[model samples]
Target: MASGADPKFEAELRRGVVQLVALDYLETPRYGYDLVRLLGAAGFPVEEGTLYPILRRFEKQGILSSRWDTEGARPRKYYELSAEGRAQKNAMLGAWAQVRDATDEALKRSMEAGQVGSPDGAEEETTS
Candidate 1:
């Protein structure tokens, strides 16, 4: 929290993963609340405020479809990944894998090289 880089990167990473993880789980029909709990259990916490809007947008965009389950004590809107969503998720998965692999390689190179530059993005001096 103290480091500026930590918060920025964490926000970016979580924002990137939200759609991936949500679609992965929504491969089956699930209500939004159920999804929030499941995502939290999976170690990727998503607040309802943050998730509901995404779900609504995806629904409107036809990336996913939703139906109401009125048979239960309370009505719940269930969402499922659409065929288009499946294709989108596949593409996102492929892109994510590439990014992850690149990040891992960068970490490997960082470990081999030690720190490449200063924390503020300044290049370290080299002596000839």
Candidate 2:
């Protein structure tokens, strides 16, 4: 009985926040396409539709600061995390750690019972 969806898959509720997440991943300012590819390599796999809007929104919200870089034939907007954004990312990371720990424990128990598909989910490859 195959439904349209894969039972092993799950959607990230963190939808529009990849820009903030990307900021934490970057050591310095990054332009739009660079940020997209970087996150994809890191396994977040952001689409341009999702990332570009978030970048603009974060810039508007003061969590990001941007400047025009004209080194190329055409200019591009480069984004860096503002002081407030860095502080917020730190706080979010702390909360995410707690969630991850709790989820890991639950998955461990479920795996022991053969209850869920992937015991470690996305964390498996990272672990070993």
Candidate 3:
């Protein structure tokens, strides 16, 4: 919570993993509170507020769809990843692979050069 620091670092990390988490849970319909509990139990570390917003954003992005089920004591909105969400998850997986491989290579080179490892590892790769 320092100035110039990313206040939502935790939220951003959760956001990055949301697609994968939602995909994993979409095997069965889940209500918002259930999703939050499951994600916490699974160690993704998200608050209910953060999870709900992300769910709504994903739905808006065409990555998910939902409906209310009134069979419970109160109506519950259930959500599932859309076809587009599945595709996006697949593509994100590929991008994750590329990033992982590139970081590993850069770390190896940095070790060879006696440079301490840093986050992202490949600052040079960020430009051109």
TM-scores of the models, in the order given: 0.84, 0.71, 0.71
Q: State model 3's lDDT.
A: 0.76
Model 1: number of backbone collisions? 0
* Model 3 misplaced stretches (Cα beyond 4 Å): 1-14, 115-128
Better of 1 and 2 by TM-score: 1
- Candidate 2, residue 115: how far the Cα is off, in Å: 9.1
**Residue 126, candidate 2: alpha-carbon lDDT:** 38
Candidate 2 structure quality by residue, lDDT tens digits, 1-128: 23456534423444534544786865488888999989888757778897888778878888789999999988988889889888877887787788789999997877765543355464333333
How far is each candidate from the true structure, as Cα RMSD in Å? 3.2, 9.0, 6.6
Worst 10 residues of 2 by lDDT: 7-16
**Could you tell me how far off, in angstroms, the CA of residue 2 lies in candidate 1 after the best superposition?**
13
lDDT of each: 0.88, 0.74, 0.76
Candidate 3, residues 64-96: lDDT per residue as tens digits?
A: 889999998999999987889888878887887
lDDT of candidate 3 at residue 127, scale 0 to 100:
36
lDDT for residue 79 in candidate 1, whole number 0-100 = 100
